[model samples]
Target: ITYRLVKEYNLMINILRAEVVANKAGELIMDIEGSEQDIAEAIDFTAHEGIEFRILKSGITLDEERCVHCGACTSVCPSGALTLRRDDWSLVFAPEKCFACELCVKSCPVRAIVAVMHLNGTVLAG
Candidate 1:
């Protein structure tokens, strides 16, 4: 499917994270970029092939009230979605780049970062 998307549809894919259980199923977190028509067609093709494609608006939420600005989550964030501001040393979250990996959730001592799965504007269990 990835091969077809690149060769046939001429789309660019950047894989963020992937988890595959042998002979069972796999999940991929990626960023795909291309022309609008090609992208739409690719999505249609994926759906036809029984692939569940979800567009995530937000993957993780940061509670400013609970957060202590310790920046411990930054060490485990693979996508740089969680970072500390240089000027004031405050924590920042970029939800668009997050892949819902849940590393920050476990790393946070203050339980400031919470993982969320959003599909079509609906929040689902992570």
Candidate 2:
């Protein structure tokens, strides 16, 4: 599928996260870049092959008032979207770098991090 997306649709895919489910199912969150027509065609092609996908704008909200900044969330963040400032030990968030993997949300001891990513008005995470 990756090869076909690259060669046939001329799309560049950057995988952000991947996981295997309880059975044989698998999930992959990726960033796909291509022209509008090519992207549409690629989606159609993949859908016909039984692949499910959603194009979403991703982000998270950090409850600054409730945060303890114990560096727990920062340690679990795979994308470096969550970090502790060296000067003050405060948590710094780079929303643009986040892929909404929900690791920080799960790791936040005070439950300060909440994923804000949605699709069709439905929350996908958090």
Candidate 3:
């Protein structure tokens, strides 16, 4: 699907994280960039391919009260979604760039980051 998007629509595909279980199924966390029309066409193609694609609504939730700004989560984050400011050493989160990989949740020492998955206006398992 990703190949088709790039080759056919000239979209840029960035796979942040992926999990594939042999003979079962696979999940990919990715970012696709293209022109408005191209993006729309790419999405339509993916849907026609029997691939379930959902725009993630919720991602990692950080509790500032519990967060200590230890920077543990930042280390494991593959996407630059979670980062620490150099001057104040404060944690900064860019929710839009997050892939919801759940790496930060396990890396957080204070358990400040929690994973939440939402699909089609309904909350799914975290």
Per-model TM-score, in order, reads 0.64, 0.60, 0.59
Write the residue-wise lDDT of candidate 1 on 4-47 in tens digits: 99888889998878997998779987778799899889989999
lDDT of 3 by residue, 29-86 (tens): 7776789899888778878887778765558888999999999999999999999999
- Model 3 is weakest, by summed lDDT over 10 consecutive residues, at 50-59
**Candidate 2's residue-wise lDDT over 1-126, tens digit each?**
778988999999988888868768798877788999999999899899998867766678999999998999888889998889999999999888887778888888888888777775677775
Ranking by lDDT: 1, 3, 2
How much does candidate 1 score in TM-score?
Answer: 0.64
lDDT of each: 0.87, 0.85, 0.85
RMSD (Å) of each candidate, 1 decimal: 4.7, 5.4, 4.8
Best by lDDT: 1
Global Cα lDDT for candidate 1: 0.87
